[model samples]
Target: MKIDTLQHTSHRTNLAQNIARVILGGFLVMAGTSHLSWSRAEFLAQVPSWLPIDADLVVILSGVVEIILGLSLLFFTSRRRQVGWVVAAFFVLIFPGNISQYMNGIDAFGLDTDRARAIRLVFQPVLVLLALWSTGAWQAWRKQQSGD
Candidate 1:
């Protein structure tokens, strides 16, 4: 009876994760699309001005990366753990842009107010957590580390 209950709970948890993963993937794809087209200008606001790299070029390349990552999340079930890590790393990589926006008071994405930018900064970790959680990467890594 305990085993059955455990199995059922696991199934439900897996289902929830799968759904969250798919939703995240879809969001990424949409965000990537916007980065390339409709929202291109808005994204430029996030690029750190001090960075030597061309802002437009950075945005374009990042958009491509986002699209690829999103597709990977949608189709790379076999390598979900690795994909999750990559996604989490990507979030980390772009965190500086969020920081820059706040520091420079660059108003984009309706984050004009300092309060808004500060609030946005707080969500970066949440995205990292979501990527790891939705992919089961955090749990898998923990389990492997524990040698369980």
Candidate 2:
């Protein structure tokens, strides 16, 4: 009975994770599309001005990357764990943009106030957690830690 219950719970968890993964992938694709087209300038507001690279190019490249990562999350089941790690790392890498947005007080994406921009910074870690959890990466890490 315990084993059966465990199996049932595991199945439900997978189902939930799969749903989250799909939703997150869709979001990434949409955001990536925006970066390439209508929302390009808005994204520029997040770029750190002190960076030497052109903001436009950075936005374009990161947009392309977002699209690719989104697709991977959707289709790369065999490598979902690695993709999760990559996606989480990507979120970490872009955290500076969120920080820059808050520090510079550049209004974009309707983040018009310091409080709003500061609030937005909190979501980056959530994205990282979502990527890891939705991909079962967190489970795998736990297993590794337990030497199972």
Candidate 3:
């Protein structure tokens, strides 16, 4: 099936959505900074042992990506939908790391218990949904799918 290049173009976000987007962006920027700096070691605990890449390298690269995605969300008005999709996918891509943390019972970011880690896992989808909803990506895709 052919994909429409324009299918994920951005739409105007209302005040609440815009606020949420900005907050999410700020959160990403902070987390990314932590990955590159003080929290680098903490983030390492999340890297799955089976991943062939050097764990440090993975952390560093993901940090960079998070920063870029965060900045895009903060400033890319005409392309927020695209950025939202990318951000959502980024969350999904990194989900395995969270799973690894849980499976290994690795404690980091104050998640010292299995219960805490499991709860953190639950928030991953919330972040994904926030990216979609705050940027209007979810609505845009639904409209397209329904042929509206």
Candidate 4:
């Protein structure tokens, strides 16, 4: 009876975590799409001048990648490992843009305050968590630990 109670609790927790992941993944996907549309110029302008690629192309390409990551998070279980890798890669790739924004003091969507900029820098890790949660990697790790 106690074992059954623990199992039920675990199942409920997993379901809740999965729901949170879906919501977070959906928000990220939508946010990325909105960035592609409403803020393309502003985001492009944030691109560091030193970066060789034209800002316009960079914005479009980044938008495409975000969309891909977002969709992968939402679906595609067969490629779960691949998706996890891609999300991690995407997080790494876009971090420079975050840095560029801080260094250049670039403003987008009217986020110009220093406090806001600091918050921006601090937000990257949350993206990885969201990605991992969406991929169920966090749950897998927890389960593996429990088995051991």
| Top model number, TM-score | 3
- List residue ranges in candidate 2 displaced over 4 A: 1-13
Which is superior by TM-score, 2 or 3?
3
Candidate 4's error at 65, in angstroms? 1.2
Going through the candidates in order, what is the number of backbone clashes in each? 0, 0, 0, 0
Tell me how candidate 3 scores on lDDT: 0.91
lDDT of 4 by residue, 60-145 (tens): 88777777777776676545544665786788788888888887788875769767877988988787776666566655556655
In angstroms, the error of model 4 at 54 is 0.9
What clash pairs does model 2 have?
A: none
Position 82, candidate 3: lDDT? 83
User: Candidates' TM-scores?
Assistant: 0.90, 0.90, 0.93, 0.76
List the lowest-lDDT window of 10 residues for candidate 1: 4-13
In model 1, where do residues sit more than 4 Å from their true spots? 1-13
In what order do the candidates fall by TM-score, top score first? Answer: 3, 1, 2, 4
Candidate 2 C-alpha error for residue 106, in Å: 0.8
Which of 2 and 4 is ahead in lDDT? Answer: 2
lDDT tens digits, residue span 1-148, model 1: 2332211222212888999889988888888889999999999989998889999999999999999999999998777777888999999999999999999999999998999999999999999999989988887776655655
Computed on alpha carbons, the lDDT of every model, listed in order, comes to 0.86, 0.86, 0.91, 0.69
Q: Output the number of the lDDT-best candidate.
A: 3
The digit string of per-residue lDDT tens for model 2 on 3-94 reads 32211223223788999999998889889999999999999888898889999999999999999999998998777777888999999999
Model 4 residue runs over 4 Å out of place are 1-13, 138-148
**Which pairs clash in the backbone of model 1?**
none
For candidate 4, the lDDT comes to: 0.69
Error of 3 at 82 (Å): 0.4
